[model samples]
Target: MTSNGSIATTLAPTRETLSSSQLLSSSISSLNSSSTRQASSQISKIYRQASTLFLTRRLPESLSTILPVITSPAADDTNPDASPEPAPISRASRTTRIKVWSLYLTILNAIVELDPDEGKQAFGSKEWKGLVNKVRDGDVWEEVVKNGYGGVEGDVDSDVVINLATLLLAHARTQKVNQTRLESYLAASTNPSLDVSSRLSTPTATRPHSRSLSPVKGSGTDTPRDLNARVKILELYTLHVLLRNNEWDYAREFISISSVLDEERREAFLQALQSLQEEQMESERREKEERRYQEEQLKRDVEEARRRRIESEEREKREEEARNRRSEKGSEIDYGVEDSPPRPGSSKSRSSVKGGSVKGGRSLPSSSPTARSSVPAKNVKVPPSLLTRAGNVVMNVRKLVESMAGSFKTRPMLLMQMLGFIVGILVLLSRRDVKERVKSILGKGWGKVRQTAGMGVKVSYI
Candidate 1:
């Protein structure tokens, strides 16, 4: 009985073991399905919230809300001390995945375009510069590829690719990296390892993963929608991006050889390319002309300023020379006056008679012996004869009369007043009583003058 029980335990399948295995498998599958659904719902919710925040112009909040949905967890994020990892984008539905990435790229573009102060205020200085640098340096493209497309460049969604190229074209400092990335994507997309026929014949279970399973609907020319998207991508690559890089010949060749475009579309694209080239050339010519005009204007302004400065300097110089000439002439006149002989009746002769020697009609310094000898002795006295004194009085009276006559020529009213006063005096004297009074006054003034003269003669004799 013991051997049989051990054998049955070893060989026979227990109902509990069978039931447990089945239950474990079902539970694992249910857990995976529930987790996928939860991730999808969460991504949709985050996308809606971020998009709403973006539309409302709340960029910082939108960036914060959408970052986790698009970014993968760091390698060290498994530690308890590390922040919790976000759900990988691959787990979400196709539509939700595209929406999340599109919102993220848009947020990045908006942040990059913000004014310096606003960007700094919205995101701190270091963070703002970092985000801007990511766009301008074309690192954002790499991030999208690595984080969103599982490091597969061709696996990126068509719409996402459009947004990436547009963002880089708008902000990147160089277009080489963008062009190379586009070419690689186009090469990978156009030259699929397995053609459409092969992929169709292959069993779904064994078929390798391709861009069909990407966030975009279909790969290459699989459907009309896919074809339209391909056309758009080609338009962006050949027209916008290649033009920016100045790859005209390569662009034309690319358009001509493209299998997707029909004859009509090809003709249209070629014509558009030609028109764009012409327009670009015209714009370049206009810009060159404008720059040349500005340079000439600037040169003219500088020359005009210089000319004005020189004229002002010359005017000032001429004025200064005129002033110097006037000063020199004045100085020469003064020196000549000091060195020339004095005139007979000038003030210099009068001054010379008092304190300087007069020889040859020139004044000499008083310190000279001749000047001392020429000066009159202080004690010398010479009395004038009566005739000489009477002659001097006559000359003074004549001078006074001549001065009065000259004054009368300039002022007729003053002359009239003087004449009227004289007439009045004569009229008063005409009266007998006035004549007798005037004769007595004259007799008394004459007696006083004779007495003063006698005293002056006595003093002179002594």
Candidate 2:
């Protein structure tokens, strides 16, 4: 009975394996059907089932089931058919492609964990680069750079693409495969140009291929959520690299971008940002202090120059005074005036002569007692010199005219009066009758004045 039971159990397992293979084959066939909606649903269902299988630790079965769905049949090159044939299938839709890549990458990661040698082989395979390129499509990256996030096709999920990119970057960094290319991919994902709204909402005429993607009935809430998720995932991925490399400043730059992660991570990012800003402010303040120090140094130099100039002027003045004193002493010796002592009575006469000489001599003016004593004679009043009095009269006339002119400058009436007086004077000078009449009046007044004065003088005598 025990032998029969063991044979029966082994046979039952063979049948179950056969049935599972059949089911997998059926699912693949459905996925490749002409009906696109049906194919998309089947692909989604296959991904879910494959993911469950992987979570349950059935790596082998999960890989086998998803691998067939992910791969398409290779073109028959040896069996050439000359007959008419339908066009070859285009690349899979974005949703279908993302699922297939996710499953493949998941299995690849498992292989890496379970078998390091196999993982190394798989990472080095040509398909590795190809898969990375598909996720980070050249055209999509270019569009993002040109037109921001809005330029990306609606079908492509930015979240999935970025996650795949993160995995590839990790692999490349570990293996030291062309760091320049991998870094560029990271730069492209977080490019500052990607700020446009996901819903471009442009007029239809501008978007010729927009009609190709059918609208989802209830995906309105989900669209924005997905976009936010994409942005958050990219932020976290970038921060992981920067933080791991100890680039605090760079990691701090993504504080706002880190909102997609949990609150705890966001707070960490915010703290880093605050620290960076504080550091920047400190640097700026230090620069300002340096500038202030330079300004103070310049002011000190100017003050030093001014002080030196003043000191130089004072020294020169002292030297000039000393020279003048020496010249005076030399002149007294040259004249030999001190050799003869003045007679007490003759002192005044001698001083008078010396003072007179000093007044006439080519010598600098002095504030000595002798000079002060001689000032009374110089101050004695004398008749005004003719030339001096005439010059004083002319200066007074000029001052009076200037005052009149100034007063008339603003007064039209005063100017007119002055002009009339000048015209009257010209008339009197030109006309003989007017001139003779003015002279006769003056002569008569003078004669009368003389006769009155003579009569008054005679009366006083009587």
- List TM-score per model, in order: 0.57, 0.32
Per-candidate RMSD, Å:
21.1, 25.7
State the displacement of the C-alpha of residue 234, model 1, in Å, after optimal TM-score superposition: 1.6
Residue 177, model 1: Cα distance from true site in angstroms? 1.8
Which candidate wins on lDDT?
Answer: 1
Best-performing candidate as measured by TM-score:
1
How many Å off is the CA of 353 in candidate 2? 99
Candidate 1 TM-score, C-alpha based? 0.57
Candidate 1 regions exceeding 4 Å error are 1-38, 74-87, 194-211, 214-219, 328-462
For candidate 1, the per-residue lDDT at 75 reads 50
**Backbone clashes under 3 angstroms, per model:** 0, 0
Which pairs of residues have clashing backbones in candidate 1? none
Local distance difference test, candidate 1: 0.80
lDDT of 1 by residue, 269-334 (tens): 999999999999999999999999999999999999999999999999999999999999999998
